[model samples]
Target: MALKEVISEFRLYVCNEWISKIPSHRFRNFYYRKVMGFNIGKDCSIHMHCSFDCAKNLIIGTNSVINSRCRLDNRGTISIGENVSVSQEVIILTADHDVDAADFAGRSIGVRIDDYVWIGTRATILAGVTVGKGALIAAGAMVTKDVIPYTIVAGVPAKVIKMRREDLTYDTKYRRLFQ
Candidate 1:
């Protein structure tokens, strides 16, 4: 690997594996923004144990709360809009290897989560999926496709269960002081 690639890997490991585990919100936020180069908006909180690959490719909007243990693979790009809630252990992936390819070539695609989206605990969002505004993804759901706006999806493959109100207005700017 090139020197730059090696340095990037080392930085990612230190920030994601070690520094991210720190319970201090202020310190974590400072490190993530100043050192990691993530485009974080106002009042955004990324809790402990959250792992993000390629921090520069990640952009989080205002009033968003990312709970603990969330893994964000930002190898391509991940854009999360305002007032979003990402529950614990949620995994948002932006890269995957094509199984049909003989060489197992890796492919990456951007993942976009629009405003007011709520991703429940332990949910896995696959690569290239665009979660529309005001959508709710149920806990443990495996999202493999685009979710419609204001819709609720659940199950293993994440099928649409219901639709949410477009008129809904709520703030999710909550974050713990220390941990």
Candidate 2:
């Protein structure tokens, strides 16, 4: 393998195996910012057991809380805005294979979660999806396309179930001990 590939693999290994197990939020955030080159904002808490595909392509905003055991696939860019709540086991993917291609090649598309968006537990957000501001994704939903602002989406392929209250003023400032 090439040297760049080797270094990327080593970084991924260190992130998944070591950094994800650390209990201290400051230490993990330090490593993520300083070493991995992720743009994590202030007052954001990413809990334990979260893994990343690549290091540099992730950007998380302020006052957001990412619960434990989430898989962040940042092969493309994954931009999460402020006051977002990403629940446990949520998978945000930015890369996928083209099924119809003759060579079965892969494609990378960014996933954008706007400000004050609440992604429920175990939700799978596929590539090229932009979740609008204040949108609520229901638990275990599979989001395949762009979601409208202030709407509630659910079920497979994630259609809009109902419109959410537009006057959302809650802040997701969760900082639990040893999570």
Candidate 3:
């Protein structure tokens, strides 16, 4: 690896191992913004034990709350819009291997979660998926495709269950004592 790449990797490891696990919201947010280069917005809260890869490619909008133990693989890009709530242990991945490729080459694509979305606990969102505005992903769902706006998806390889109300007006501004 190049010298710069090696240094960056080392820094990422250090931040993920120690800095990201810090419980203080102010400290974590400051580190994410000033050190890791994440584009986090106002009143955002990311709880402890959350993991992020390539933090520079992650962007979170205002009033968003990412609960504890979430893993975000931002190898490509992850753009989360305003007022979104990501529950505990959710994994948002942006890179994977192409099974059809001869060499099993790696592929990456951006994942976009639009405004006012609610992702339930332990849900897994794969690469190249755009979860539309006001969508809801149920617990333990594995999303491999795009989710339509104002819809609810559940189960493995997540299928659309029903539509949610378009009149959603909720802000996700949660603050914990040891976030």
Candidate 4:
């Protein structure tokens, strides 16, 4: 294999197998910021058991909390804004294959989650989706398109259920002991 491919494989192994399993938040954040080149902001806590597709494409803002067992596919890019709360087992994808293409070629687009957004447990945010600020994604919702600001969405291929309160002032600064 090529040198670049080898290095990529090694990084993936270390991040998924070793770093994700580490109990200390400092250790994992240190590796992720310094070694993996992710742009993580202050007071951001990414819980254990979370995995990533790539390293450098993620940019997280301050005071955000990513819960455990979430899968972040940063093959394109993932821009998460401040005070965001990503619940457990949430899957955010930034890349997928185009089934309509003749060769089934791959396509990638960044996923953007605005400030004060709260994504519920097991929610799946698809590629190229832009979740608006103060929006709430219900549990198990499969978001396919852009969500409007201050709205509540639910169910598969998630549709707007209701308007959310515009005065969202909660800070998502959660730090669980030992992940």
Positional deviation of 115 in candidate 4, in angstroms?
Answer: 0.1
Q: Write the per-residue lDDT of candidate 3 for residues 10-109, one digit (tens) a residue.
A: 8788778998778799999998998889999999999998888875998999999999999999998999999999999999999999999999999989
- Residue 21, candidate 2: alpha-carbon lDDT: 93
Model 4 lDDT tens row, 17-79: 899999999999999999889999999999999999986999999999999999999999999
For all predicted structures, in order, the TM-scores are: 0.96, 0.98, 0.97, 0.98
Best by TM-score: 4
State how far residue 138 of model 4 sits from its true place (Å): 0.2
**Residue 92, candidate 2: C-alpha displacement in angstroms:** 0.5
Model 1 lDDT tens row, 1-179: 89999998999999988899898988998999998898999999999999988858889999999999899999989999999999999999999999999999999999999999999999999999999999999999999999999999999999999999998689999898655
lDDT for residue 135 in candidate 2, whole number 0-100: 98
Error of 2 at 45 (Å): 0.8
**Residue pair clashes in candidate 3:** none
Better of 1 and 4 by lDDT: 4
Off by over 4 Å in 2: none
- Model 4 is weakest, by summed lDDT over 10 consecutive residues, at 167-176
Off by over 4 Å in 1: none
For candidate 3, the 10 contiguous residues with the lowest summed lDDT are: 14-23
Clashing residue pairs for model 1? none
Q: Which portions of model 4 show Cα errors greater than 4 Å?
A: none
Q: What is the alpha-carbon lDDT for the whole of candidate 2?
A: 0.95
Q: What's the true lDDT of residue 23 in model 1?
A: 82
